[model samples]
Target: MVQEGLERLMDRIVLAYSGGLDTSVAIPWLAEKYGAEIVTVTMDLGQGKELDDARERALALGAVRAHVLDLRNEFARDFVLPALQAGAVYEQRYPLATALGRPLIARHLVEIARLENASVVAHGCGTEKGNDAIRIDLAVRALNPDLEVLEPLGVWDVTKQEKVAFAKKRGIPVPAGADSPYTTDVNLWGRSIEYGVLDDPWLEPPDDVYVLTRAPKDAPDLPAYVEIEFERGVPVAINGVTLSLVELISSLETIAGVHGVGRIDLLENRLGDTKSREIYEAPAGVLLHAAHNELQKYVTPRDLARLASEVGVRYADLVYNGDWYSHTREAMDALVAKVQERVTGAIRLKLFKGDHRVVGRTSPFGLYDQDRIAQSADTRPSLELRP
Candidate 1:
């Protein structure tokens, strides 16, 4: 139960509601416990039916109002494209999907709070004592420092199972089935699953946990070839077909998912002092990142690429740790903008089960000198390498 003083402190609260077990429970809890009016805001970053159900569920959970904002174009044009341009990847494998989505979601939550005249902004993120809470709170503070931030799960003195029981006791329908052996977060860039059975790093992930890519053994026998075109570092076309950013990414997901081209299982250092096992399925993102990196090899200088590589890791850390709206992230973005100026090209790739091999690449800005390096050229003895 909430303390009387805290309840008086928040008469109107704007919640980052997803209609999930945590946020759904939060809606009624804030109302009943604090006498607060709950206004739920759900951001649409191309998570599909999940967003739709969240809106419906928020209203059903006694929220005074529910707002679903379609931020797909913003997500693709702003977040995804910047990462693509920067060639940002966490540890050269994971596509910061949910990580990239956080700042935008928190931004909207703050905006809604301001518009609704809400004194507080609440989120479902539990007190994991990690970067996510820090990230959301930071954004909230930056946007509206006066708006008190409330995290029900952060303060709630109960285990996850206990929270589920509390929801059930209140007649809130949790997602069916006992929770999967892993906790999964999904968005446009990709899906990441971890925890539960995944804690045992030695054990292989069960088949049921995968949502995007097919298992390697189940992939097709023949290889598929794809050509990707880029302009100023953003993917514009695939296989010579031009598409909107969202369509292009979606098409790549379908194509690459079939070939089992993107699946990663690794142990990563979390914001806390522990290391956790994580599995990711990011077919399109993996393909694009590879192609983008290969293309950059031709256009970008080695020194700039090296610097960008370091910045890329820091950029990924910021996203993963929820500092998306911070000065460090903005500085990283500026660095990426400068480096991406020359990253214009097209790359051809051969895709097989769980593998993507770049066959060829072309760019108007290519640094490769065909005349000097051609296989048919005579071996000219030289005292020193020339630019």
Candidate 2:
């Protein structure tokens, strides 16, 4: 049975497809229910060879066309770098990796929709109970109101198991099941794990939830030292060797991961109106943010540092809440860019078991006054009755 209003409202529908269980079902479901031709877009933000398979799957699952765009550089330079510059962390924990990526994906969805002359954009965002639906929907509305956004699973009464069943019944291929009991999303910046037993805050996340790191105990016996170079707050090199944005981050991930540098567990406050236990593996992002923060302390004034911290939190909130296209976010970006002008330098970091700290920092623009603070002419071993 055709859905009542969809027939008139949508002709061709462009979908932000992931080739996951929900989105695999969406290709057929949208066609059957809305009689709309489906165009699928999958972004490659350094998720590796899976995208080639995903594109193939999207077409096999009944998409009229599938586009797989490599957006790694743009994602890093435009979205990820700005987050790093502001030291953006949601709730002071999450590096906003997943949050930051959604807006860029949403923008691409609109672009595909326009090129395809589609009247509607759709996502397989599973439930209204998650932040992704709100983020993707708000971005679509903000960027292109002419295109109606659809969440097929939000209205459909299908459970996860049923969706899997539907895929099997419909002859759509599904990835083999794993014993690992977590839902995961990975990109160049980090990996985020949620769902399954992770919903319980009291239970410690199983070691399998982590993808980019070893357990601190299992890390190498020796500590690893890394030096990151920054130009205006964006990381550009590792140990003085220049690299592209993506390569720089990837190198840090390996160097930091060897010593167990990034692992975070939080009972995060979600935009969906609940607190959720989320685990993140952000070796590169964590190390870069730490390096950037330490370097900024050398060059940034106290008052500006305090204010930038405040701006970072607000920036995190906006990015997390799907307000990335808003004027307020643009204004905040301007402030962050100004603050980053003098944040050019290098930071040496010592990475050990589950912890890392800045061991040294240097910058031509540094505000540290070593001669006065460390070796003053009038310094004395003991002061008598100064008070």
Candidate 3:
């Protein structure tokens, strides 16, 4: 039955394989169901060792070809930088970590589809009516309007448990425990956890659930002070130590995570029309956003900063709703680029017990004139200024 379906449309298929449960199962399922030549492409957006075994796992799962592209620098410069410059935080908190990564993944999927000349591009994104499906569909359609976009899970009229049972019956190796207490997404920016016990807002997140951030009570006794230097809105140095983008983020993550500086718990509206309680640990993101905002206080005028903040929220929504490649997003990017022109500066931050606060900020192109403001006649008391 599945074999016949594969035989009919199995000439070639390009899959955005993550080597996760669904994707790992999809590779073999597509090959068996469509008998198509499967080509897998995994984008290395700093997922660490999970990506290390991606090619091997893809081949092991019966993919004819596999490629893992290192997109760290491109992801940082192209996606992360623009979002950071715009101060695009969703719901005044989220850094749009996974949301920012999806478009790049879709772009790579399109490229791989073209390279493989695959008749169809497929993803393991289930019919959850979430941002993943929207992102992939929008990106693929924009890049190659004629290509076929396939979503197996969307059409599969089965529950997750049923899918697991079918895979097991077919001798498909599934990840340990088909059901997990939570669903987690991790990247360079942060880690977000949803589902399971989190559905109840009243319930406190288990201590073990937090991986990247130290517990507030467990944090160091003394405050840790650090200085971050930015060039055109991107961090280039930490505590006088110059580093590359990746190095800079990594360094900050280590420093901030230890102090429990970035943990957020919120009830956010998912794209799927549900109110979800999500917990995120984004130490570096917290530190960077605070430091950057502080730096802007010196470099950008009050009105410009306010406008940028407004635009940032809009930009965050667009990205979250899978409109990364939209015209409005491009315009917003241009506006952010202009704002970042003078956003070079150093921000001094103090971290202690799950908090990262700005203590001082300075910029070469600062719009601030402290001496003039201090001497302003408006600041003088009426009695002191009496003629």
Candidate 4:
């Protein structure tokens, strides 16, 4: 105990702060536990302008300094675009939005830790059963193994009620909706809701839990049609109007959400062979994936197409299992990029009542030979086989 206390006096910790109770409480707890000075890093990864207040909250909670970086553009270009082009949907369903965001956050956490010369970096992934802990830890270790990765919540091992009580006792301003049963994570790529009644896999997700998408039954009576254009596997336009990647995705999220597309409910296989009941709203991800996938069929040859699909599944697994910075993922990305060379095209999709389907596709590199494929039998040459 004497030696442990001595080590605490020299500690400086950098924490990933979200304007939430878990993180807010972590500030005081980490300082008290390690007798350390706290430096907080809050990232704006399409969460919104509200994250600005997180810095103030961190300071109020006894953090020595706070850094908030706007990483939305980098996230779209460096993370979302590559995952989309690679077709990285974990378990053939989730777009891996939450999973994708973790590594980027972890990368920055290490950067901030290095800048502060902190001995330890921490995050608020509270549950032992969840995957974010593994994701953040792996990314941190991969980037800079010398720094200690701290998970205060993991060590605290307290229930949500306990956490709330602890926050209140410490005079931490718990965010509004702190008592809400459902826990959610939101970003540009998607929004995920879990816990509360959602823990019952047999129960339907309450309508209140969803934000980005409307209920399928509540969607409009008339069907909607959209044209999405891609350049080398990246979505570049919507309905013939060119836009920035962020703008394109945001627009599609609204459009597809209005039509009640991209609501996913699944039993996700987390790391360590555990399972989780998860609900996700990813209007833009679903639409873009549908369009990009259909366009690939039109442009990619059969053998290469098959190979790309296989690589995509592996890529998805790697992302889900928290191997984002692995050399294997880099190699797979090279192949995915090679396959996407000809995936330049436009795909027309019909959307109605939570359903989206590809209606048509056109591409300069399309391999479909209409004359040969659509020819009648009489117009085609007959071949005879020897007996």
TM-score, predicted candidate 1 vs. hidden true structure: 0.92
Error at 327, model 1, angstroms: 2.5
For candidate 1, list the clashing residue pairs, or say none: none
**How large is the C-alpha RMSD of every model relative to the true structure?**
3.9, 2.6, 3.3, 3.4
- On residues 233-350, what C-alpha lDDT tens digit does candidate 2 reach at each position? 8788898899999999889888888788789898888885778888998899899888898888789899999999899899989998889999998999899999999999899998
| Pairs of residues at least 3 apart in sequence or in different chains that clash in candidate 4 | none
Lowest-sum lDDT 10-residue window in model 4: 1-10
Off by over 4 Å in 1: 1-9, 379-387
True lDDT of residue 366, candidate 3? 84
Candidate 4 segments whose C-alpha is farther than 4 A from its true place: 1-7, 374-387
> Which scores higher on lDDT, 1 or 3?
3
Report the error of model 3 at residue 95, Å: 0.5
User: How high is the CA lDDT of each candidate model?
Assistant: 0.81, 0.84, 0.82, 0.87
Query: TM-score per candidate, in order?
Result: 0.92, 0.94, 0.91, 0.94
Q: How many clashes does each candidate structure show, in the order listed?
A: 0, 0, 5, 0
- Give a tens-digit lDDT track for model 1, residues 101-120: 77788789888987898878
Q: Kindly list the per-residue Cα lDDT of model 3 for residues 81-128, writing each as its tens digit.
A: 788888889999899888888888888888888888876888877665
